[model samples]
Target: MDNVSWWAVASALAAGCLGLSVPGLLATLPLRLRPLPRLALAAPASLALIGCVGVIDGLLHLRFHWSHVLIAAAVIAAVLWPIREKRPLWSCPRLSALLPVTASAVSSVAFALVLLHQVPSFDLFSQSYDNLFHLNATQSILETGNASSLQLRTLINTDRTLSTYPAGWHTAAAMICQITGVSIGVAFNALAIAVVSVAWLPGIAWLTSLVVPQRQRTAGLCASLLLGTAFGFFPYALLIWGVLYPTFLAYALFPSGLALAMLLAHVWLPRWAPAVSDQVRPWAWNDRWMLLGLAAVWWLGAFFTHPRSLVSMVLLIVPLVLWICARAIAVAWKAGGARRRRMLWWLGGAFAFVSVAAVAAILVVFRVFHVASRPVGDHLNGPQAQAVQTVWDGLWQVLTQNALVGLGLDMTGSLIILAVVVLTGLVIALRRADLRWMVVAYALIAVLFALAAGSNSDMTKILTGLWYKDRYRLSALLPLLGVPLATLAVLRIAALTRWPRVVALGSATIVAASGWAGLWAPVGAAAAHEYRLENVKTTDFVDSRQIAFMQQVADVVPADQLLLGDPWDGSGLSWLYADRRPVFPHLNGQWDPDRLLIAQHLDQIESDPAVCTALRHLNVHYLLVSTGEFDGGDPSGNKFAAIDAAVSQGLFTPVLSDGESALLRIDQCS
Candidate 1:
């Protein structure tokens, strides 16, 4: 990596650490010493740390390109520094803060262990199609020294055409590639295993602080630890599917945005009952403005990083804007002129900032990427159609069977159940006129928006053809969001009952148990099955065979050649091999002529001499086929029979085959 790049990454990390750790250090100060201190203290410390890291990277020769790490760290520091002094740390005595930190540390360690054990299995067989695109983009940039005109179509042999997928993710990876000059494998491994998890931690901490009360701060901290570790640390660590995709990063932002929104709402609402004698306070506006600012930042990040997330935010924000408007109107109607003026200013300012930020993001993305929004359509057909059905069924099973215990990682149903539960909690809380419950409701809606936006179906049909399947259900976030709300509910219920403490303890136990069961039963089972059946050591499946065949094809094809194939087939090809771009016939409801040529009538292409001539005319170098028959009926039980006959005529050469599938190299037909 260049000196500047190294400096950027190093500085980012240093800044993040300094910003996050400073609050804990301040918590050690006496209560009297903590009142109205200079908020600038944390900011300087974080900036200084970033500067130091940059200086060290420039001066010292650190082998690994620490630039991306530094950039991410610095970003975190910049975010946390301003809020550090303003937000109250849990009012714990010196030693008390250690308990939550300890809990978080333990959970982090456990999460690391789970990830390490599962990495080998996930890397070998599971399709990391998104990572392949990143690698392809990075390679093209490295070779050509230009980001634009670096074609994705040439890398994978498919006719789906380019422009369906966004370039931002690839751009980020290419930036990393420019610095490290390492294999794509190493770069992706670093991103999936480390960068994403670290980036998520601070937001998790901030959200935990918001949801957990002052008295139960330690437990809240523990809850954050549990949420982050359980949902993010453990599950993502064990599965290749979740962490490698941009959706994971985008989904993480969902909670952060929701938390900030809730905080803003809390600040805007009248703290005291509306009465003539009620006294107004200066600090009342603090949470409102702080939250609005934070929400704007999160929205911007989500927009640039992932489009699906941006879509989800819109769905969530519309309802919230209406809610805010209603509350503002209510406050204005009842309050005096002076009070009304202040409220209007606060509401207006908050709205303006958020609106500006969101609009700027949309315009920037469109301009930089040259993305044109497309309409959504029903794309699931054939095996994919069946897969979608199974996915839906699986989701339903998750909700019904493991509502409280949760269906664990890779289960969409758990997420749905959790959403339902949160909604139910919100309804109960709202009926009882509890402010906290309303906050949770808003948070849940925001999270749902993020999830829907990041969803594979949404992305494939709308933003880009990049799909991570059902993993985007984000069951982990459910637990993270649920724990504190459930805890509070338990506490409230206990307060009203004779056996309040017992009930509270019982509820906590049930939740923890449910979490443990969810973690172990279905998610663990799926992971274990994947590990046992498809690990690098053991290869015994159709997917593996397909992957190996595609790898062989990648070896022979020129780095710049594009392969045209079926959408499902193309995804598999692009994912398994580097520098091979597959063009699917239809992506995000758009069809490309080049992709259509390859997808049309393989059976006819095999039998007709003229079709071979036409294929060669189009510069088609090879044809790949799996076991299944094409749209036309098999010439025999074997779909490749007529293709085999064509090959025997010496027009095409059989380059590679695993007995079941084959790659036929196209030669000029004489």
Candidate 2:
């Protein structure tokens, strides 16, 4: 088979094999109880299995190759073989009615896949700044055969500590790349598209299935389609804008994690905390063990994939638990005397336990998300006008900005419309048990956003400490609350109007179109070959000539010698694609002491023996000069001045020149 064909086959087998594993089967149990088709479980199951594989590989130090993945799959299959003989995949009796919803979700994914496939070259490498670490880190995982980020530090800087960064995405991509002989970049991009299409799209459908009534599946499905398509920041913007592949993967898995938590909470809480039974109708399903197991596996998937996502789940889940406790206490009070005291004590213990657990979890989060070695008290810089503007901007963007809108559908207008409709629906059906949870969820998110939007430095620290204080990251999660309310609004409006279907379709169409507008450039950029240095500065087309020049330098430079190059000139790609390590692995040069030292005297390297002494210390071999786009405009302070000075002082000899860039051997270093 050709390389592309091999990649398809390998990726299919890796995902398929994972799906057939024990955790994969376990993860499908809760979803199986729903009236959805078996295929709905494929993506989530596959992703959960990938997380399982990551854990196994990390512990065993196994190389992330097809052989290792297959072995792990075999072990899981072996354990589950006896159970599979007795029970087959569940068949949905309502499959005929559910086909449209399923088809809509699948089609949305397929459309996204087509757009992603059309991107130029399919080289899979992102042109964004952050992709330097992401792409190189994946390459490191492949080279070392260690899927654990803890030990995968050789790619970026050898001085960096054991990494706490999530490695599940990299491991999955590395498996595809190793098995198919594709580049890590190609595998990574393909994996990302697959995640959005297969994992995220279906996962949303599954969450909708959990939240919406069985009869109203179509409304929920429609809402998911709009969410998958129309929302720009979530699956698309996060993928393209920040090139946050790990975060995207975590977010994609979040719906499934939430759905599983909802199921488990509904079922398990009643038995453990019976005082909370007034608010929760204890589900007495025969598959209780299966549901518990499924929730555990999904939570594991979330924790390993991205801690931020796991934290989001906790925030959402806590409100439901508190509501349950509050309801039980109210019911106990109505019953009077001993029952009230008993319920109080029960809830008091529960509250204490939850408090302790939350504190412990937050500590873990603080450590995992910590920005190591940075000066903490160096206050964050913001524009003078931003303090007040950010309060509104952060709150508004959290609610409405991520998705694209048009045809006079302003985000503020949309929010006002949706709020009016949802509140109207809640009043119309005040007895809905589900509405309570929905309201609680929305309220919790609003509170989080309020804290996030606070102008105080401490609030900023809290937000950053919790979710990187990134508005984009917070916005990426808005759809979870946004989509459900949107669906509710459409349904409520339909119930009020004589033409329900018309109202629903109209809302879906507006949402879908507006969202599609937001994603046009990002999706189109694939084929357009555009790359963004940052969100504001975008290069229309990737310059392949510059890439070729870097590759030539990589080929000539000794493997052990470190080269110095400006990261903004895309030297990180050389480390990833050409196996050449640049002094600065990331675009920001302020963090690394050694890199900062080199940068401080780069222009004086030819005349300054001290600078030459540092160069010799690093075993520096060459300097790469790019005649392309870079951060700073000054030629003197930038890489050009340093190169010109070196040449004038006869301290270096030009070994290769490609007009676009050049490689200078440090032959006359001090």
RMSD of 2: 6.4
What is model 1's C-alpha RMSD?
Answer: 10.8
- Give residue 550's error in model 1 in angstroms: 4.8
Local accuracy of candidate 1 as per-residue lDDT tens digits, 1-670:
1112434434333333333234323422222112111121222222223233323442453321325334545565565555455446545557755655565555554554444444343233223324335555455544444333213333443334333333333434444445545444444434443323444544455554554445454454454554454442223532443223555545545545655555555556544321111112344455455445445544544543456655544444454556556665676759868878887787789789989998987676455434655323333222211132234443443233232111223441243333344455455545543343345444553333233333435333333222322323333344444544544554555557776545544544454444444454445444444433231212222255565667777787776655534433333244235346444322222333433433444446656566655555455576665553222332224322444344445555678787755776666443
Clashes of each: 28, 4
Per-residue error for 466 in candidate 2, Å, reads 1.1
Global CA lDDT of candidate 1, please?
Answer: 0.43
Residue 144, model 2, lDDT: 61
- Lowest summed lDDT window (length 10), candidate 1: 31-40
Which whole-number lDDT from 0 to 100 does residue 594 have in model 1?
A: 36
lDDT digits (tens) for residues 369-483 of candidate 2: 4535443333333321113334555456545443321111112223334444445534533356544765666655655554444454654655554565554455567666555
